[model samples]
Target: MSLVKRIRDISVATLNDKIENAEDPVRFIDKYLQTQKRKLTELEKLYQQTLTHAHSVKQQFMEAESNRIKRENQAEVAVKAGEEQLAKLILLEKMQSEEKSEQYRLLYEDGKQTILELEEQIQNLKDEVQELVDKRAFYEAKIESIRLQKQLNQVNRFIEKQNYYDQSRSIDQKFSELEMQTNALREVRSNDTKTGSSFGGKLQSEVDAQFQQLKKKLEKER
Candidate 1:
């Protein structure tokens, strides 16, 4: 193979290896399909070349066979005319043509078999590549689904925590308000009792003073 052809083969093989071992199923599958396409393209080129070679070989064999037949006919004619030397030359040429034809035929047969093997290899490679692509898609979808589920779970947990914190803060505020109200009420009651006791003591003192004045006035009039 030429350098360019060799490089192409190596590229395809490397891509195939990467596709086979990729962790991301989606990427692996896509790349695998791409590699298979490339491989098929290369195989197609090889098939065309094989076909051309086979055709050329067949053509050569056909020409050689025709020449051989003509020489044999010429040799028969020469023998009837009693020209032994010419007939001998013709027979020798016929044998050589037959040998060349046989050689071309064998080469053609070999080329044909090689072409068949290459085609079969192409088919098998396509089937295996397709199978791997499908598996990659399936695994990728499964991983995506699991990833989404995990994200949703985290969001739900965060929301629950937020609600819990809000409720806790609300309860604390309400309890603080109730405590203030209770303290206010108690203070009002204490102030009221103190005011009432002071008024009662002042009223009793005024009544006693008035009674003493009346006793002193009565003694003066006597």
Candidate 2:
């Protein structure tokens, strides 16, 4: 295996574990996402550089191959024209071109492989960042739900307290009404007693007058 075949792998296991075990998941996820984004940016830049280098190497290889083919044809033409020395020189150039072409070919292949690995790493980084974003959203929603529930509970307690107050007020009003009725009954009894005393005095006076008349008539008869 070529040394270029070894690409650094991106790992998110530690970050994921930290996020899962964090006391403040929201804050942890935010920081983790930012870090992942920065890493992704660096990896993307590296991938672009690798791709450019690979293209340059491929171009060089193609140029070298074309030169080799041209030199081969030139060498053949020189030999046919009875120019032995010139043909020898052209053959040497062709060999050099072949070597150069091979070297560039190897370089281009290595660059391409490196680019592939970098792309994979970049994709993984992106995936991890996206996962963190989703987690952040989930945490935000959960927090909102908790806030709403708390508000609902508070409102329920307020309503219960208001109902209790209203009931107490109602009982107080009923008690006041009962007290007023008792006072009115006492006033009526007092008025009835005064009227009965006046009627009894008038009856006693009439009886006394009738008894005196009967006694006076009996004395006259004696």
Candidate 3:
């Protein structure tokens, strides 16, 4: 495929979608960047070679034109010396050289145009490479930032959960202590009731004995 076409394809690729779907996004991005760099290098080499070829063709055209002019000068000198046949032969050679020079000149012009286009394409590819490099760095940093934010969120959730657990444990301990205090209070109340009943029964028995003795003393006095 043409280099420009290939670069265009790469430039318009759905890289974000590819990265999102990739199992190893970072690795995928690295590989993709490397491929682009290699393509850029190849395109640069081709551009240089095209420029060199254009220069060579231009030199060829100049040399041919120089030879054609030399031949024309020689033909004029021959005609001045009254050598018509020699002048005719040199004129014919000069025409042939002129034709060759014209052909080379046309080729050189075409080459020059091609070189200009190649240079433009090479510059475009360089710009694309630079843009991609910047994009790669931006994406890498963004991914890292997202990862850090996720980690921070996870840590925050863990801390929240731990605090909840601690509070639950504290509540449970307080409830257990309240339950023990309630039981202790019930036990103390039960003991106090039993002691009061025992004391009241003993006092009633002593009063009954005193009343019986007073009744017997009054009967004896009667």
Candidate 4:
């Protein structure tokens, strides 16, 4: 399937190939894991079938060899019993059993080789699938980080493109103007505080002089 091809192309050996703009790397990896897992199951079933075949071949080879030995014994007994015709028949049967055993032996050996190859394939495929399963979280998290970094880069570009620095300057200018106004207000309050104290002293001195003049007039009348 295309998923197999896609996943296979992401080489861990070569650093050149990158995980591209896959919308979801997890889904991509999962598709591959699922497909390979199916293949692994099929391989195991075939492995079992080959094992059964190999067992059958071995059994056939053993049976033929056993028959050959039995015929040889019978042929010796026949020859000792002075039965030449039966001995000849038994010898012929032994020869045929010997040939059959040889053929079965070859078949059994070939079956075992086939089983070995299939076992290797199954194990290799199983290991590859498991590696993907184990590394799934790591790759997914890395891809997510890449996606966020890309967005952050885009945001920084937009800020530069839209002249956000000028906006920042305008905000700074407003704060500066606000600070100046505050300073002006503080100076005006300070001046008013000093002027109010002087005016209070002058008014109090005038009231005291008027009170002294009224008391002198009352003393002159007495």
Candidate 5:
């Protein structure tokens, strides 16, 4: 397998970029969404590549380990058969394979870590995009509510002005009833003024008021 260049720092912090040409909240959200999508797509592709590279490294490590073990077994058989020269050559090959395995193992581990970080970055981007979508929804609702409330206020003002005569007529009728009650009370107080603040006289005057009302009713009938 061809050697791959190491992927350095892959942080979501690096994903942040200024959104341009946005006029309003919604537009800002739109532009931000576009940028995030593009970043997510690229990150995902990178993740796949990283995954494939890690697998390649793992395969190489396994192959090198297998070769080392095979050579070690072959060397042991050669030594048992009294072929010391052959055993030395096999042992040397085994050492080379062992070293290669160690190197590949380290690379595979590094690749795995890179893949994890890439996955984390992708998820973070997705979460941020979702958060922005929620904010856009909230902003849209608030903007629409403001527009509706303005229209409602205007309509209510016009309708309230239209109802002025009706409300005033009702108020005037109540005022006239209050005025009548006030005049009756004034008449009572004036009539009681000559009674010299006598409680019994005031009580008797109130009692006589009912009879006066009955007499007025009888007069009306006649």
Candidate 6:
């Protein structure tokens, strides 16, 4: 199939998709409503044509019925005139007229049924178009709600990030304060470590010299 045909086929297949998946469903509904109006116009035109055809068929049927009745009356008159052969001929003609009338009557009846069916179809189409309009409105509302939720989510994220930034700033300020306190305490304890390490360094030097002297004496003995 061609592209146009494919699009038309898809449009027909998912007639409701026009509303359900529409980005702007209200606009879509408006367009669909216009399309339906045009379709209704076309259906009306065809309906008028069908009605005209039915009317013509009915008129023809009436004429045939009238002819049949006239033939029967003529036949009756002929019979009363004491003309037996002519009466028989007139009766035969009357029978033919009746058959023709019956055929026309059947045609008229069939046309009437067809016209009724068309009217029903047109009504059904109109109802479906209304359903489309209602559904489009519903979906459009849903879309707006979803969009609002997404916007809310975005705003919430921004607020959360802002809160995180505020917390980080507070933590940084606390750490800086702790660092200042730690430096002050270390300055106060600096004299204590200097005195302790001075004594410790002298004791370690004496122990090392004594061990070396003992090692020398043992080597000399060996």
Tens digits of per-residue lDDT, candidate 3, 1-222, equal 766768677755766678778886767778887887888788889878887898888888899899899999999999999999999999999999899999999999998888877777777777767766776787788889999999999999999999999999999999999999999999999999999999999999999999999999999999
Candidate 4: residue 126 Cα off by (Å):
1.0
Candidate 1, residues 72-145, lDDT tens digits: the string is 99999999999999999999999999999899889889989888877776766666677667777777788889
Q: Candidate 6 at 171: error in angstroms?
A: 3.1
Where model 3 places Cα greater than 4 Å from the true spot, the runs are 1-25, 216-222
Off by over 4 Å in 6: 1-40, 85-89, 174-222
Q: Compare candidates 3 and 6 on lDDT and give the better one.
A: 3
Q: List the residue pairs that clash in candidate 5.
A: none
Candidate 4 lDDT, 1-222, residue by residue in tens: 344444544544331232234566677778868888999999999999999999999999999999999999999999999999999999999999999999999999999988987877776677677777766778878878999999999999998977887888989999999999999999999999999999999999999999999999999999
Better-scoring candidate (lDDT), 1 or 3: 3
Lowest-sum lDDT 10-residue window in model 2: 2-11
Clashing pairs in 4: none
Evaluated at residue 190, the lDDT of candidate 1 is 94
**What lDDT does candidate 3 reach at residue 111?**
88
Candidate 6 scores a C-alpha RMSD against the true structure in Å of 12.2
| Displacement of the residue 113 alpha carbon in candidate 2, Å | 1.0
What does the lDDT read for residue 185 in candidate 4? 99
lDDT of 5 at 37: 91
Q: Clashes in each model (backbone N, CA, C under 3 Å)?
A: 0, 0, 0, 0, 0, 0
The digit string of per-residue lDDT tens for model 2 on 48-152 reads 888888989999999999999999999999999999999999999999999999999999888887887787777766766877788899988988999999999
Which of the numbered candidates is closest to the native, going by highest TM-score? 3
